[model samples]
Target chain A: MNGVHDLGGMHGMGPIDPEANEPVFHNEWERRVFAVTIATFGGGNYHVDQFRHAIERMGAANYLSTSYYEHWLHMVETLMIETGAISRDELNAEQTKLAKEAS
Target chain B: MAVLTADMVAGLASTGASCRLDETVAPKFSVGDHVVVRNINPTGHTRLPRYVRGKRGIVDRDHGVFIFPDTNAHSEGEKPQHVYSVRFTPRELWGGDASERDSVYIDMWDDYIDPAS
Candidate 1:
């Protein structure tokens, strides 16, 4: 439970650099990812805290390095697999298919 | 049973049924009461942040009853109980160099605290 997400009273994370004129999202994919995550959670498979726990379950190294919405994307994928919503193979196949289609 | 319908999702998105104040089960600590957070290390999910555990604080405000997250996240039960905002002096938690003029107030459930002797 003691993951990077609980960075409350800790020190020495470096200064938080705020972006000037930052867009609502840095890119479009993040918006889609956010929508999917919200929709998945809305599906009633899990509660908000459960989603947070899944996010917290990420390895400390990966959790700390990834961007904010990247964490959301990873956790949503995790919940999808965990709840039998989608299997690992299916997710991989879909991603691969999407990548090919994108190219 | 399956995924929530669009209407249901819309309904679920707006409100929650977690906060419920039960009159029969009274709050043990009241506002201005001094209490110490029980240093518990539960294996599952908990709302009690890691930093605030085992720290002493004053009951600043009664937030009223709400679902206890410790149980709620684990599929145990709602376990609705009175929640109080505990104000901790920065010095009490973070030690020297912490500003004495400022404090951190964390919302704590009744189950998480005990009367400080």
Candidate 2:
């Protein structure tokens, strides 16, 4: 069996390409909106034209390094802070509570 | 911020839940097929770990599709990511020098694999 670290050189071993690697978002909300819109409005598979392009433009390294849910978490957390869905202080407290609970 | 509490977040979670399944329906592929996981990077969340990208593997079993968990993390809700058990030879990922007796197993979705010759 392969451990998670064993994946270091697997598919992403080639030289890093800056042109191919771009941040998919101008800001975090853009990312959240893209995901929300895809999940809520698009097909079983999210296929928004612009958003898809943005994601493709962001190379595989940053993309794959993130957890499946983490991308969404980053997006939504930004959106929450930006759109007032949740305040930064509130988010921090919640996180701390969750961490303490875990401990 | 203090106005919002755990109960409110929990309520939003239930209201936003989205895995959108058709349990009555069947999935398309099985384990062992060489498949390519679609390269996706959404704003809110994802489950596909970065370590396994573009690598090839064989299906080990048919893990039925379910709502993706990444959505839950983003608080956007859940959606299905067809999960499957995939086996990757250590050499394929690490290098030819990797132990011959060693191989790796991964629980990947259908989009993660492509035909391996």
Off by over 4 Å in 1: B1-24
True contacts kept of 1: 0.47
Candidate 2: fraction of native contacts reproduced:
0.03
lDDT of 1 by residue, B68-90 (tens): 77887777887878998899999
* CAPRI verdict (incorrect, acceptable, medium, high) for model 2: incorrect
Per-residue C-alpha lDDT of model 1 across residues A49-84, encoded as one tens digit per residue: 777788788888998889989999998888788888
The alpha-carbon interface RMSD of model 2 comes to 13.7
TM-score of each: 0.88, 0.43
Give per-residue CA lDDT, model 2, range A29-98, as digits (tens).
5677555644432322222222323333344666568754454555445544555555999989998999
Write down the C-alpha DockQ for each prediction. 0.51, 0.06
Worst 10 residues of 1 chain B by lDDT: B16-25
- Return the lDDT, model 1, position A54: 81
Model 2 Cα lDDT, one tens digit per residue, B22-44? 56435456654776555564444
